[model samples]
Target: MPSEIKLVNVPALGKTAGYSHLAEVRGGRTIYLSGQIAVDAQGQSVGTGDFTAQARQVFENLRLGLESVGLTFNAVVKLTVFLTDMQYLPQFRAVRDEFVNTAQPPASSLVQVAALVRPELLIEVEAIAAAP
Candidate 1:
C-alpha cells in the first residue's frame, strides 16, 4: 500500500525551515523519523568538540532512531543534515557512508548553520523513511 505524506508540525514551533509541517504515514502504518542528534541512549551528548566523532555518533543515533520506529537506513528516502561548519562536510560524509549503501543512495541535503542545540554539537540530521 502507498503511504500518505503529511507535513510534520511539532507543537513546539508553529513552523520550521526546509521541513514539512508534519509528516503523516497512513498506509505504511510506520513512523518516519526526523534526523536525530548524536545524543546517546542516555540522552547524553556523544561527540564533543570533534566534528568527525560527532558525525559518527550522529549516524549511530540515527540508526537507533530508525530502529525505534521499526525501520532502518534502507527505508530512508531522504536525509537533511545541518552542520555548524561546512569545513567538516567531507569528514562527515565519510562517516555517513558507513551507514548507507551508495549503490542506490537516498536524496540528501547538507547545510551550514550558525549553531546547533549546543555549542559543542557540530552536526544534526533528519530523515524521511518508507515502509512496506
Candidate 2:
C-alpha cells in the first residue's frame, strides 16, 4: 500500500489471519532494519520479563527507526519476530496488530528461541521494507 509492495495469499493454503504468505515487490529501495529489542532511548529495558510490554516497545522502536528513514509501517514488506516463549504469540499478535495493517500485512515469521542477549528481554523484532 505504501507504493508497489503487494500482499499475496495463495488459495492453496488457508487464508491468512495476521500476515500475508508472500510479499510481491515490483521495484523500490529495500531497507533492512537491524533486530530491535525492547530498549528505550537511554538503552534501558522497557519491560523486563513482560512479553506484551516488551513487544509493544519493540514495535515502537522499529517505528522510530522506520521514521528516521522517511518510511512508515505501511512500507514494511517482511518482518521476523523472535520470542523467548512460544506462548506469548497470541499476546504479541494483539500488540502487533495495533501497528501493522491487517488488510495488507507483511510477510512474517515467528520463532521461539532459548534466550536473548538479556534474560529479562522477552522479544525482538526486525523488518524489511521497501520505499520509492
Judged by TM-score, which candidate is best? 2
lDDT per residue as tens, model 2, 38-125: 9999999998878888999999999999999999899999999998888998999999999999887999998999989887898989
Report RMSD for candidate 1. 8.0
Give lDDT tens digits, candidate 1, residues 3-113: 453334466866433333434455664445666787887888876877888888888877887888777776666788998888987897688788875544565677899
lDDT of 1 at 55: 86
Question: Candidate 1 local accuracy as lDDT?
Answer: 0.71
Candidate 1, backbone clash total: 11
Candidate 2 similarity to native, TM-score? 0.96
lDDT of 1 at 87: 91
lDDT, model 1, position 114: 99
